[model samples]
Target: MKATRLNLAPWLFLAPFLGIFCLFTVWPLLRSFILALQQTYGPGTTEWVGLHNFRYLLTDPLFWTAAANTGRFTLGSLFVQLPIALGLALLLNRPGLRGRGFFRLTFFAPSLVGLPFVAMLFAPILEKRTGLINATLHRLFPIWDPEFAWMQEYVMSSLILAALWMYAGFNMVYFLAALQNVSKDLIEAAEIDGANAWQRFRHVTLPEIAPIAGFVTLLSVIGSFQMFELSYILLNNTAGPENRGLTIMMYLYQSGFVVGDLGYASAIGWVLALTLMGIALFQRWAARRYEER
Candidate 1:
């Protein structure tokens, strides 16, 4: 009996977390999965319709559009955000850079701002007239039309720019940590072997931090897919002109709340979850293959 009690004590201590996790996270996920298999009209009004929601989703054009937008954002993060963060991290990691703390803080301040706040702040700044960005562009190049509607004309690009400003610093912090962990001795040995700066970084620093880089990439991809608040707040809760900025999450929100199709929304959520899981698995496999090579 004493041995059994001792064994149960650990679970006793873990009970709060386990209970909360089951009630909040696990339960909701399970409920959503079940809901996705049903047809919902209102609260407490649902009819089981197995596989119907999934079938409709596969045929839905809006679903495909949302997926494309999300894919674009994910690709932009990989191609644009990653390189910029790495470059800034490398620059700040230099041996004798002055006022490094201030520079880091300046760059990282945007990430500290809440997503809604960032969107609200940029809305006025990107406005056609009396906007900071247009005003500056007018001052810099008077030949060009200053009244260009950026959010309307370049919907995804505009969002990408805002995202770049918001997340570059966040990713830079990770890269900076990775850069610091790189051994100075290895770098010096590479230099002694007549390796150039790029060669040393390519051979020594990059390989050492590749795991962290991969982790950052995975996180960025997940965040891109989950983007809703920024576009919602920026585009005034409407998917931008032509639905260019419409993302899967935003569509899910609309279908579940606006259209009162809770079952459909739940289905969208599961599709997103499955897609993210597949991408994460692929990333893990790719990372392992790279390491082996």
Candidate 2:
């Protein structure tokens, strides 16, 4: 009787959260998936059309381009952002770094500044005519006549740098937390023997925090795909000249809201959900394998 009561108490306590999740997340997902296979146009008119939307997606050039752009952004963040973040984490993790508190605040302040502020600040910095970047370049080098439109040609590069600036420190905070939990006694023992910094990191610290690192990687990938507000607000939703910043989310917005292709937009969203789930599962598998090894 006591065991039954205890089990029921937990479920009773969880009822509100479970009810909310089902009402919001689960219901919307299932509804969207159903809508993806049906033509959703003109009020009260939904025609069931299986595979047609998928066929359209397979043949769409812009869909392919958007996928490519998203992939590039994800990869670019991994390449640039992860390394810089990890480096900062390492530097901060060191035994005696001067003014650590001040540096931590300065580094993380950019991320805390929020998207609206970042966009407002960077819009002026990257404006082709009067941008600070071009101004400095022209002042330093007479041959550097950047008559080419920065918005058109350098949108991808500009967004990647912005993403790195906004996110790297946030990621560093995670790494810093992970590193601190590491067994200091083990690292000292490793140091006593002939292990160098890289050796200690690889053999001691890295393994200890492998799970956190893997989780952070998955987070970064997921976050990259969900990139929207920055480009939408800053680049004016065109991905800044030639749709170079047109992420999958932005594309979904264009289709669903701007163009009013509700059916096609739902299909895109369904695919995105599936993609995120797949990535998450794959990351889990990879992490499991790493642990096994």
Candidate 3:
């Protein structure tokens, strides 16, 4: 009886969490999967479609456009944004740097601002003629075009730049923490072996912080893939000219909410979920291989 009661006690403690998880997470996921297999006409109208939605998604041109744009953004975030973030973190992590706290705060401040606010702020800044970016460039270089169309032509570039501004600092925090945790002994030993600054970083600092770097990369990928609000708001709730700024999540939103095709949206959501899971699995496998090396 005592052993049974002890087991029951643990379950009793877990009951609230399990109930909440089922109600909110598990149930919603199951329902979404079911909904993905059905065609919805309205709030209450649905017809069994089986694999039809997934089949249609494969041939959808708009979906492919969104996928391409999203892939570009993800690549930009992984390569450009992450490198800059690590550089900033390295700079800030230096010992005896003046006003380190102030610099850190300044760099991280943009992340604290809400996405909507950041979108609003950068929208006018990236504008032509009267915009901050073009105006400054034109002022500095007389030959520069002040009327350059950033929002229209360079939609992905504009989105990538804005994301860099907002997220670079946030990602820097993770790198900074990882840097701090890196062993000074290993760094010093590498230096004693006549290794230069870059060599020491490559041999010691990088290996030490690799796990954190991988984590940040995963986070950036997921966030970039899920991008919607920033692009939507920056492009003024449209997909920009020629649908250049259209992202997967944005397409999902348009399908589910705007076009009243909840079934198709659910299908997109599952695709996204599966993609993320695959990426995560790949990362894990790669990490294991790297560690073995």
Residue 34 CA displacement from its true place in model 2, Å: 1.1
Query: What is the RMSD, in Å, between candidate 2 and the native fold over all Cα?
Result: 2.6
Q: What TM-score goes with each of the models?
A: 0.95, 0.90, 0.95
Name the candidate, 1 or 2, with the larger TM-score value: 1
What's the lDDT for all of these models?
0.92, 0.84, 0.93
Candidate 1 has a TM-score of 0.95
Give the per-residue lDDT of model 2 (tens digit) for 171-288. Answer: 9999899999998999999999999989998999999988988888899999988777767777865656667878888888888777776778899987888999999999999999
Off by over 4 Å in 1: 1-5
Q: Candidate 3 lDDT, tens digit per residue, 214-236?
A: 88999899999999988999998
Off by over 4 Å in 3: 1-16
For model 1, residues 56-80, the per-residue Cα lDDT tens digits are 9999999999999888888887899
The list of candidate 2 runs beyond 4 A from truth reads 1-16, 42-45, 141-143, 146-148
Q: How many residue pairs of model 2 clash at the backbone?
A: 0
Q: Show the lowest summed lDDT stretch of 10 residues, model 2.
A: 142-151
lDDT of 2 at 284: 94
